[model samples]
Target: MNTRNEYIYEFGDFCVDAVNHLLLRRGRPVPLKPKAFDTLLILVKNRGRVIEKDELMELLWADTFVEEANLSQNIYELRKALGESAREPYYIENVPKRGYRFVGEVKESVVAKHADKVEEDSDKTIKSLAVLPFKPLITEERDEFLEIGIADTLITGLSGIGQIIVRPISAIRKYADSSQDPLAAGREMKVDAVLEGSIQKSGDRLRVNVRLLSVRDESTIWADKFDENFTDIFTLQDSISEKVAAALSLKLTSEGRLRLTKRHTENAEVHQLFLKCRYYWHKWTPESWQKSIEYGSQAVSLDPTHAPSYSWMGASYCTLGIFGIVSPKKAFTKAKELVEKALSLDPTLSEAHEVLGAIKLFYEWDLASVADSLKRAIELNPSNATARDLYALYLTAIGQTDAAVSEVKQALEVDPLSLIINTDVGYILYFARRYRQAAEQLQKTLELDPYFAHARYALSFVYLQEELFDEAIEEINKAVTFSGRDAASSAELGYAYAVAGRSSEARKVLSELEKQSKHGYVDPYHIALVYIGLDDKNHAFKWLDKAYSERSREVIYLKANPVCDPLRSDPRYADLLRRVGLP
Candidate 1:
């Protein structure tokens, strides 16, 4: 049997996940004899150097006397498993009278787990906890995102334990200052426990110290320190979550322990790259989203089975499509492929399901599939704020306004200060046609961050729906300015201008959009919106049809958009709604 300390090594299209004793080629598992597999692992671990003939025998068979021919047969069988030979090795290179070496470039990956404790529990005592960001002290790398990501990763692991409600990253984003008291911070977040930690480096060694504080008493319930080499950094992160379970005196099941300890990739650099890129990705700005894709794609290339990295890549593509940064059909197709691959590698990945659901809802026009993926995502990770936020949007689009409101409310609770999430709440209320309440909610959201472009953009839609033309124009102008006059916001500005009866200004902006479309992407839905404001029914229909064919994102809003009421009477509009798979 393989030991728990083993890892998966990938070269070319093949992967060997030693912990699971899995050998996969292009994502499909390959079967191998136990002895043959062990031989492959020893060769893989010492890939650069050729093992001596006698040394290989002793390593494989500790005390037993293995015949020379038995070792030779195992090598032949292992080579067959890899579809290689001693003559021309694509993976293993065999030297005459000497042993073997792995020839191909290898990426080693391992999932860390908790094994020291196996006690069982029937019930959980602690309900909630917030894992605050870890401080990086005496650091050489000087990367803030990497420092914070250690705690964030632990939060994800702890959240996987069914009995606990671990606060999402957004909840602690504002409390990342090293000076903040953990007990006070936990109380502010309304959690029962606070997990605080710091990472300190001494040469190639790392010393991590963690304390779990009870918010109820402002007392440390548990504290521990871990000292290990830098390469074991992921193990330290996993152990923190395990210790949390241990501290609670609640035993974890095998599945729960696995979830708490699993690291997506064994490459520490790739892990850091993923965290830094994800930090920028969550910013939700056009420039930051593009930057995330560049870095996220790099991590995926290094470890194709890295599910979380694939999830990020898919989400970036999906967001770009929605924001008109890329062609929706092209972006959605790529997004679907990536998310599907991510799920294939790890079906429990909640973020990947959310991306897939978004694609189905916005582009594929498959509402049934969309519902399944989104619901499954939430079921797997209830603390996933983005999944809840997205499901809220889907519910709103389909006219389940009350359900939409409830979902967003839950999301907002987890991410109370998130500008985008707060903006979404106002948008959901607006979809329910509670215009006065929607306006107030949006105003509050804007008050939190006056320059939050999405909140301003959402406010414009509410204003236009309420027929407050001047307010619509003002809010859209703010959005346009804040977004650096991006095509989507500029197009909305043109639409609002047309609705306000400023024909000259509206036409000038229309001309700008027309000119820009020649050089960059301009969603057909935006052009349709401008036509709607112009009361150009035929032109509006024309662009809506184009948007539907291109799977334009805003097309999903056809049923909920109050400004499109004029077009709702038309047969083409109903057909467009039908094509979007909305009730």
Candidate 2:
């Protein structure tokens, strides 16, 4: 087939220049996968007409056998690139059982005069790259979660090199189950190259077979096999990242170089325990949190000087506070002690610094200390998304809503698909009293992960603030079902019931909660939320005071919680806020 003259299609600020193979927004190139680009080309070529999804997929895949899911992913990327909506179509319209259609107008410009020059310029080499989550080598009897953790750590380490646009772990996790071609995964993720690997563990040793592939041609750039004891897992992770960075011709900073050589533990058993702890931590559920703590404790017992294990142990305790499963006083104390021990073992541990900051801000109510710790943590590892997200929370607590939002934006840049970070952004918006915006963000998060408990809970809270009692009840019910007797979820469910005039059920639930609290203190802040839902300000304030006295971490949110807005008008509310150091 003869090559036709290339052209540029312009609509609004978006320009798709076929000659250069680039999509530009306001004259600057926007990063997009080649498949996505091809999809866009097809759409623009048939602008104003609906293109069947299968037809488009056939054009994109050509001779390959690809699933419908691949087409859906392409559509998602296309929409994201256009900043368009799936529900309210602006550029592409979903034809339901049919397919998709481009609805936007296009004006094409002849590019035959500059086609060769544009093509030459398009070949500029990428100075830095990231190898996303590689598909597991095999599907049977695989430890998928552990593989993901290893990939995430490697990406994080490589990102610390400062010159690479390392794809976030959350984005890469989407391809964890991929059985397709490695080149296809790389194209989907819009990366220049990909590191594909398979891990096999036998006794205390690990065998990792890895290959670096150039996405453009599916050509192997480098390949290696690493055989190492489990005790050297961290070192192995560092080696992989460092080798990739070197292959890409990127300069590693002194700190990055140090990290590439650092060893957190040399005990194989302890390392295994730490990996198991990470496996559970990634689960992000109440049950998994407990399991993580158990595994972390085992790691500590086996290697008392292991800083990463202690840091993760502290993080597990922090999760307990968030779930209202344990009193903040107890949880934070343990977190503080573990983090301190971690820092004592290795003051440079970024995770320990981050968790310590959270402990200080939410439990101790020490804003200055939180700032210091979070800053140090970020200084140590800028690629730590958890640290950035927690720092954003601290910013929100201190009435720096705009700054907090900016911090979360940076975090999203690193962890684009992180459910927790997305939920955090919604929570920050909620605290900023932007109920509708919060609802929209949380709804987007739910769309991404329908069963995400925290996002559902936050959506319920946003609905309540918007006076959408019925919607709030529905979401709260979902949260309760997903969380299953989680104290925080149950407390919120009780509140939703009370607000919706299900007084009998609310009272019954509250009674059961109180009875359960006879052995352990029920979170006073949660009780206060339920009372506020009942419009019993007096009881709400009473519980709020108790929560303050108990140093409840939930109380840290009093200053910004919309449910507490009614209480905020009362003098006692100010007193409680001040007492919690939140004023």
Candidate 3:
């Protein structure tokens, strides 16, 4: 009964969607009679200008002989739907002896419509796609877990398709806000199409409505609705993937078909827990990672055969170890055991292999096995951004700096919004000793998230290399504060102090780090960094030995980290490199 238009109007919390013939308040649809919506559209279109009652009735009814009362009734209904009393007249104001005027301040936005195409042009390929988070049926009450979970599942199902580039969850998470326009998101992501949807849950059942839209022409490529028990979510996912693939005319390979229909766990509850775990994991904070572990452990306990749960937990532990939130030995041991268990259960698990590869590269220092695992992980799922990111790190460790940069850049294409990925690109450039380029890259990363301590800490390294001591100290100092004075950030601050001739402050920071190591699992490598800065070669070598004996995570960066430049000419440095298996 409604025709689409390439325009939308926004005022306060309401969106007048001429394109959909719907009035949404705070992202939830409000029921309005067809005639009432038509009247509202006209008033909003001609806001701040009054039309006489005769003109308003004639425009709405055309040749039909409609009474003035009918037009007045529509206005009354519009006012009620807008939550305004006629007397208060916030949105609709009646001019004496004239038609009503829309008083609300409106912001108009035009949806760009691509050039018209004939039926032959319908064969245009849908190469890249984005699945945005679903909106809830109720605006005031949200089920964020379910909303993100469904989109994430669909993303995973389609990611293995080589013919299509499906944007990862990290890149699409920002669209979780229901207010986001799907086409706008698609344009920003530079994707061919977008899958936008809404979900409603009642008791043990769900009602979902989804439509795949073309970003080029705003055409509906495919649309569907599902009503089923919540436990049947797997079937919903399979149906959606099949329909989308068919709509796009993708001739799926056997592997892609299998991937689309694969079920990691039959138990719906365990699936929900796994989704919650991943949701928190992407938050990329110490507290969030801990929460991720808790949820992942719960999922694993509930369904031990859920390989993804184990792998995700392992990944969380790996991150904790790298950030010094957990001791290296304890964290790596737990992470390795978990991922190994995951591999034993599901040998083809891409992320499980990724986690194993990271453990081999960073903890065991088994360079021989690292490449195989990472390559296998990527071969299984080319869209696994984390695998590519870790592979970049491995390449950097092996002195393949150019390959490492390429790999990280590829990872960015998959998850352009990932804070860690952005930071890693700059870090990889830093390790390559391209100080100016690294500084530029890190500054861009800071623009993405100014308070991201990791980016600031990395930018500090770039500043230090450029001999910008004051800037380096300021950056690391902010990094320390932003990271809640984490040991890694504090150690970097100490290094900046020493390099800038603030030996007393550097020693103060070193003293605190030593105190921390006495009680907790502080990486001695951090202490060594300060020693190297202080030009205390003997003490630096002493701590580096301890680091090697302990297999500190930071040891992998020895071949490239500029902070160790002072000791590079020493025979001990060569011996350490030989012992660590770095050529």
Candidate 4:
């Protein structure tokens, strides 16, 4: 019966992740409404035989009164979604005046559970936990960043303890409501316990109230209140983290103990500025990223020895470069310099190593050496989900699908609610050539946040691979709109147009990109994508060469990106891969 794990049904190129309620074909999602999918599932389950219409209707519409039209509509939608024609059906066969049956050969396989299963937290001796963002007690005098920043710091401290799985701030920040129940949030996060609190400020005095609640029993495991001088936030964070760890009965190593009390900057004001930088950084918008860099730069100026500030600033620069908000050459160069400075100042900083890994991967194309930096970052901070995600990306670029999927899955466990990590999962699956699974995963991400541009952009790739050009163009159009016509999304939209056989529209996009390039930096790799889509091999190679010369971040994925499939057989592609040193 396989009670512990669910199953995925594979037939031809289609996969049905039954537990996730996802249907994908050739790694691209086939969007069927609930009833349509249910209808398809029943047919697939009863394959090699036909079920009577009356019995099938009863199975599908149990305890509900539904007409024959409703059942017929579901079948119609299922066939449409699956691209199954009525006259010559490859999958679903309609039994004349009787019922329906799936004609394709089906293979059922159990979904492989991860070693560190998040869902079984209650049964584990070592607990999984989440620290919800501390609400502001005094609404009129609230410092939003400080309130959330306190919880972020606590999560960072507790993450060093190998005995506990502390959910990253990104996973729990959404539970910031003053009236939200900690137990409810804990249950939603699937953690054994939750640490939640409130922050209040009055002149030079700062006060915080916190409680650790057991999700299983809805009991307060520990509770406390602290009143300290505003400048003593470092001691406050240390006290809270240590007390929570003690309450959990975690056996922390000496290094974990030190990590609990570690301070990047002694200057409280500088720390505040750095927290502000982090606050904006997590917003994941170009303007917010710019604001993050501004705050980080201010922190650096205020306390030149604050290595975290430099690391975060470097991260912001790297993100901007990757997003094509600025020239990759300019952004990555500055990012590399800042990250190197951060490393020189504080060699143990995990974030610096993560940023350095990204710089090495995207800028230097130093695939051989990138693993060391990424691994070091994870070693220093196991809860560094971003580091794990980037490492997964590096693994994908080097053609290690299984390792990449595993690494990204671990990242998802740590920060399950992170939009970017969720998108990265789909993106990696896309590179793995599991288009259906990619589409399913990405569609679920969109369910989390419909307006997330990157998820849409990633889904477009899955659609392109499936030759669902209209859906691809539609998804990329939303991505372009959501991302404020960001060059990357805009470029992808052009590629979609070209691939869809809309040459005039694709050329129009190319012309627009050229004009935009005159005013601001545009990745040559983007132009190359459109050229490839248009089947202009010469033009594509020209732009790709430019991208190579500029060390554009997008070029690093040459080995894995399906858009570059057309170029792979070319000698120039092999030379590019050799020059970039990618295996």
List all candidate RMSDs to the true structure: 18.4, 13.5, 21.9, 15.0
**Deviation (Å) of 170 in candidate 2:** 5.8
Per-model CA lDDT versus the true structure: 0.79, 0.76, 0.86, 0.84
Off by over 4 Å in 1: 1-125, 139-141, 181-184, 249-251, 486-489
Name the TM-score of candidate 2: 0.72
Model 1 residue 197 distance off true place after TM-score fit, in angstroms:
1.4
Task: Give the runs in model 3 whose Cα sits over 4 Å from its true position.
Answer: 1-123, 486-489
Please identify which of the two predictions, 1 or 3, would achieve the higher TM-score against the true structure.
Answer: 3
Q: Quote each prediction's TM-score.
A: 0.75, 0.72, 0.77, 0.78
The ten-residue window of minimal lDDT in model 4 covers 115-124
- Give lDDT tens digits, candidate 1, residues 1-583: 2223446799888888776566778875554545677888888888888998799889887886545755775787677667888786888887887877777899987775433321111122456788888877654544478667887798788776545667887677777677788888887677778888887777778888888888876778899999988888888777777887899765566667887898889998788778866877777777888888788888888877788888888888899888888898778888888888989999999788888888888888788767678767765676777887988898888877776786688788766767888999998888888888998998998887899888888888888877788888888778878878764437788788888888677777777777777887788887888888899999889988988888888888889878788898889888877767789
Clashing residue pairs in candidate 4, if any? 27-435, 27-436, 28-435, 28-436
Q: Evaluated with lDDT, which candidate comes out highest?
A: 3
Point out the higher-scoring one by TM-score: 1 or 4.
Answer: 4
